[model samples]
Target: MKPLLLIILYCAAVTLPLLASWLVGGPPRPFRHELASGLGILAFSMILMEFVLSGRFKKISTGIGMDVTMRVHQMMARTALIFAMLHPFLYRGTASGGQRPWDPTRQLTITTDFYDLSSGITAFLLLPCLVLLAVGRTKLDYKYETWRLMHGIGATLIAALLLHHTVYAGRYGSQPVMTWLWLVMTGLAIVSLIYVYLVAPLRETARPWRVTSVTRLTPGQWEVTVAPEKHPGLDFKAGQFVWLNVGHSAFSLKENPFSICSAPAAGSKISFMIKELGDFTRTVGQIKPGTIAYLDGPYGSLTVDGRNEPGIALIAGGVGIAPLLGILRELRQTGDPRKVKLIYGNRTDNQIAFRDELDEEDVTYVVSEPTAAWQGEKGFIDPALIDRVFSPLEIKEWLFVMCGPGIMMDIVEDHLITRGTPSRHILSERFDYD
Candidate 1:
C-alpha cells in the first residue's frame, strides 16, 4: 500500500478506541480525568500496534522501509511510556471509594478495587523498565537473542496487564462493547507475535536449505552460500535480505539478518557476504557445506527494479557492499542499459571483496588506509570524493544507493542533498539498528 494511506490507517486505528470511548456517552468528568483516559487509550492502542510494527510484517515495513519502521517502533514506545506514566497521576484529585451515591458505576471516582487497579500499577512500573531496557539493550551486554526474548516477554506481559486494566478500570472500558473491542484488538496483537515466532517458523520448516559454500573473502569476512534442499529457491528482489538460521532448528533464535549478495537471477543458490562481528557470525568460516538451515525473509525495500532513473550510483563501506553487489550483479545479468557506477570504500585494498569481478570501468575504489604502492582514491567517501566522481548533472539526477556505518551514511546523504540531489534520489540503509 502507499505510505500515506498506511499512515492514515495507522492513525485511525490508534485513535479508534478513544473515539469509541467518547461515543459511548459517559457522565462528564473533569477535563484532566477525561484527558487521562484518552491518553491511556491512545497509549494502549499504540503499544498494541508496536507488535505489528516489529512483527516483520512485509506489508507495513516494506511500504515504509524497515529503517523507518524500526525507528517508528522505538519512538512510539517512548511516547506510549510517557502517556502511560501520566495516566494515573491525572486521576489524583478524584475521590477514591467503594461506591458513590452519585456515581454508582464509579466512573467519576478512582476505583479502590485492588484486583483491577493492581494490573494498571504493574504495567505502569513495567512499561518504563521495558523501554529503558530496549534503549540500553547494547549497554546491558545481553546477547541479541536473549534481548529479543526478554523484549518479547516483557511486551506481552505489559500488553496483558494493560488489557485487564483497560477493560476493568477504564471508565468506558466497563461497557460490554468497549470491553469486547479491547479483547479483539489485544488478541490481534498477541497473534502478531505468534505469527512471527511460531507460524513463520512452521512454514519455513517444510522448505529447508543447506549450506553450499563458505569461502573466506577478507580477513574477517566470508561469503556464504546456501541452496534449497528440495524445493525451488527463494523468489526475492535483488537487494533484499533474509534471516538465516544455520545448523539450528527452524524455531531457534540463532538466526541473524544478512543481505543477499547474490542476484536473484544468479541461480537457485543465494550467497551472503558476512563479516565476523558477533557470536553467530564469527563462526561463519567454520560452517559445514551441508549444515541445515532455514531462511525467513526476502525482506527489505532497497531494490531499484522498476525505477526510472537514467543512471545509478552505488556507495559502499566495508561489508556494506553485500546488497549493492546483488543489485549490480542483477543489472549485469539482465543486461540492463542504465549507466551504473560503484564507489566502494574500505580500510584497505585487502578488505575489498570481489576485486576480480568488480568492473574496473565502473568501480571507484577508495581506501582509508591504502598501502604506499596503492594509487586509487586515498581518502574517505566524503563530499569532496563524491564531487570528484560525478558531474553536476549526475549528482543531481542519478539515483544514489548506500549502505554502511551510520556516520558514513549521514555524511554521504547530507552531501548529496547539499549537491542539489533531491531526497528521493538518495536511498540508504544502516547496518546497525541499535
Candidate 2:
C-alpha cells in the first residue's frame, strides 16, 4: 500500500474502538470523564497496532521504506505513551466508586475496585520504562538481541495489561459491544506477533542458505557470501536488504539486517559487505564457509530497476556503499545505457571497500582523513562535494539514490531540494532515524 493509504488505515484502526464506544450510547457523563475514556481507548488501540508497525511486515515496510516505518513506529509509541500517561489524571474530578445501583450504565461513578485498577496502574508504570529503554537502547550495555527480545516481551505484557484494564475499568469498554471490539483488536495484535515469530521462522527453516565465502575487504569490513542450499536464490531487486542469520537457528534472534552487495544477475550466490560495529557484526570474519544461514528479507525501497531518469547518481558514506554497489553492478551486468556516477566518502583511503571495482567506474572517492599519497577528492561528501560532482542539469534530471549517515543524507537532501530537485527524484535510506 502507499503511505497515504497506510496512514488512513492506521487512523481508522486506532480510532475504531473510540468510535464504537461513542456509538454504544449510554447515560451522559461529564466531559472530562468521556475524554479520559477516549484517550485510554486510543492509546490501547495504538499500542496494539505497534505490533504490525514493527517493520517486519513487507506490505508496510516496502511501501514507506523501513526507515520511515521505524520512525513512524517510534513517534507513535511516544504519542501513545503521552496519551496513556494523561488517561487517569483526566478522571481526577469524576466521582469514583464501585458500580452503583442508581447508575446501571456506570455513568455516575468510576470503578475503584483494586482488581480493575491494578492492571492499569501497573501498565502506566511500565509503559514509560519500555519507551525509555527503546529510546536509549544504543547507549545501554545490553546486546542488540537481548534488547530486541526485551522490547518484544515488554510490549506483549503491556498489551495484555491494557486489555484487562480497558475491559474491566473503562466505562465505555465495559459495554458488550465495546468489550468485543477490544477483544478482536487485541486478538489481531497477538496474531500479528505469531505471524512474525512463528510462521515466518517455520517458512525460513525450509529454505536455508550456506555461507559461500567470507573475505576481508578492509581493516574493519568483510564480504560474506551465501548460496541457497537447495531452493532457488532470493528473487530480490538490487538495493534491497535481508535479515541474515548465520550459524543460528531460524528462530534465533541473532539475525541483523544487511544489504545485498551483489547483483541479482550474479547468479544464486548473494554477498553482503558488513562493517564491524555491533556485537554480531564484529564476528563477521569468524563465520566459516558452509555455515547454515537463514534469510528473511529482500526489503527496502532503494532500488532503481524501472526508473526512466536520464542518469543515476549514487552517493555513499562509509559502509553505506553496500546497497549502491548492488545497484551499480546490476546496471553494468544488464548493459544499461543510462549514465552513472558514484560519490563514495570515507574517513581514510584504506577504509574504502571494493577499490579495484569502484575505480573501474566513474567514481569520485572522498576522504576526510586522507594519507599523503591520496589523490582523489579530499573532503566530506557534503553539499559542496555534491555540487562539484554533478552539474545543475544532472542534479535536476538524474535519479539520486543514497544511503549513509543520517547527517550526510540530511545535508544532501536539503541541498538537492534547494537546487530544484524534486523530492520524488531523490531516494535515500538511513541507518539511524534519530
Candidate 3:
C-alpha cells in the first residue's frame, strides 16, 4: 500500500504540471510550474524527516528496516534538493528547445542567470548542510546541540530560498488557483517545521520545573524531581518523554529527552528516575531548580489503545522503567482493569528506581544480585521464566511492551518470537540514543 502510494505521488509530481499546462493549451506557465515544484518538494521533505527525526519510525523499524528507510530518504532528499536548485533554472523566464512546452529539460542545466544562480547557490548550500547533518549523525558523531542548531537554521534558510525562487521564477503569485495551492501547502509545511523546531523548543523553555530534589538511589543510580513554579498543568501521556535542559538554560539548544516517572495527573510536578549513564545524563543530578528549564515532548505511540490484545506485559530493566511508569500511571488514572504483568530487572532491590511502585502493580521483581535477606526471581529475563508465567493462549493474546537497554529488549523479543507470538505483538522502545 505504501509503495503504491509513493509511486502514485511520484508520478503526479512529475506529470501533473505538464498535463495541466497541456490542458490549458500553451507552454507550462510559471504558476503551474511553481505549484508543481512546491508540492513535490513538500512531499519529498516529509519522507526525509521521518528518517532523521528520532520519533515513531525510529522506534518501530526493526534493525535492517531503519537502514533501508534512511538510505531511501537520504537519496530522495538529495534529488529533491536538485529540483529545488533547478526550479529557476528550468522554469524561469526563458524559451527552450524551439519554444516547445513539452521539453521539460530544455533549460535544466545551471547557467549564469542570476535568479538561477541564487537558487542554485541556495540549493547547493542547503544540500551540503543536510549532508553534513547526516554525516555528523551517522559518521562524524557531532554534538547533538550543535547539529540541532545548524539543522534548524539550515532548513529555515532553504525553505525561504525555495519560496523566493518559486515566487520570482515560477510566478505562482499571479495565478489564483496556483497561488492558493502554493500558499496553503507552503503554509502547512512551514507550520509543521516551526512546530517541530521553534514552538516546541520554546514551550519546553517555559516549563517552570526546577530541580528541587535529587537523590542517589545507589551507585550509578539517581532520581531527580523538579518542582513546578506554579500550577501549570503539564498534560502528558505515559510512555512519553519531556526533553530536559540541564546545566544550561532551556533557551539553549542543549536539551536531553527524559521520561517522567510520575503520572500526568500529578499536575504541576514531574519526576524523572534516571541512572548515571553517560556524560550528559550524569550531570542530570547537578541541575539546580529556580533555573530555567524546558520540556518538549510527550512523544511516542507505545500506548495501549493500538493493541488488540487481551492484556499487557511490561518488561523494564533499570532506567528503561521511565516510559513504563508513564504507561502504568496512565493505567492507574483510567482504572484500566486489563491484566498487566511487569517483569522488572535490576542489580538488586535497592538499585531499583521505583521498588514500591512496581510492587503495587501486577508485577514481579527480578534481582540480578542479591544482598542480605532477599529472595525473589533473579538473573536476566530468560525464556524459562517467560514460559513459567504465561500460557500459550495468554502469550498469543497479550501485548508485550518492553523499554530498557537494547540487549534486554532484543533478548525478550527473540524469546517471544521463538514462541508462537508474532513480531507485531512484541513492541520495544530504545532508551539508548546514538
> In terms of lDDT, which candidate is strongest?
2
Q: Give the TM-scores of the predictions, in the order they appear.
A: 0.98, 0.98, 0.68
**What is the C-alpha lDDT profile of model 3 across 324-370, one tens digit per residue?**
87778877777778888888888787877666666787787788897
User: Candidate 1 residues 85-190, lDDT tens each?
Assistant: 9988988868897897988878788888899899999999999999999888878877999999999999999999999999888889889989998999999999
lDDT of 1 at 345: 96
Quote the positional error of residue 191 for candidate 2 in Å.
1.0
Note the residue pairs that clash in candidate 2. Answer: none
Q: Which stretches of candidate 1 lie over 4 Å from their true place?
A: 359-361, 431-434
**lDDT per residue (tens digit) for residues 1-434 in model 2:** 89999999999999989888889868877888788888898899999999999999999999999988999899999999999999999989777786677887666787888999999999999999999999998888989899998998999999999999988888787888888888899999999998988899999999999998999999999999999998998999999999999999999999999999999998999999999998899999999999999999989999997799999999999999999999999999999999999999999999999999999999999999999999889988888889989999999999999989888998999999999999999999865744
lDDT of 1: 0.91
Error of 2 at 99 (Å): 4.0
Q: What is the C-alpha RMSD of each candidate to the true structure, in Å?
A: 1.1, 1.0, 7.0
Root mean square deviation (Cα) for candidate 3? 7.0
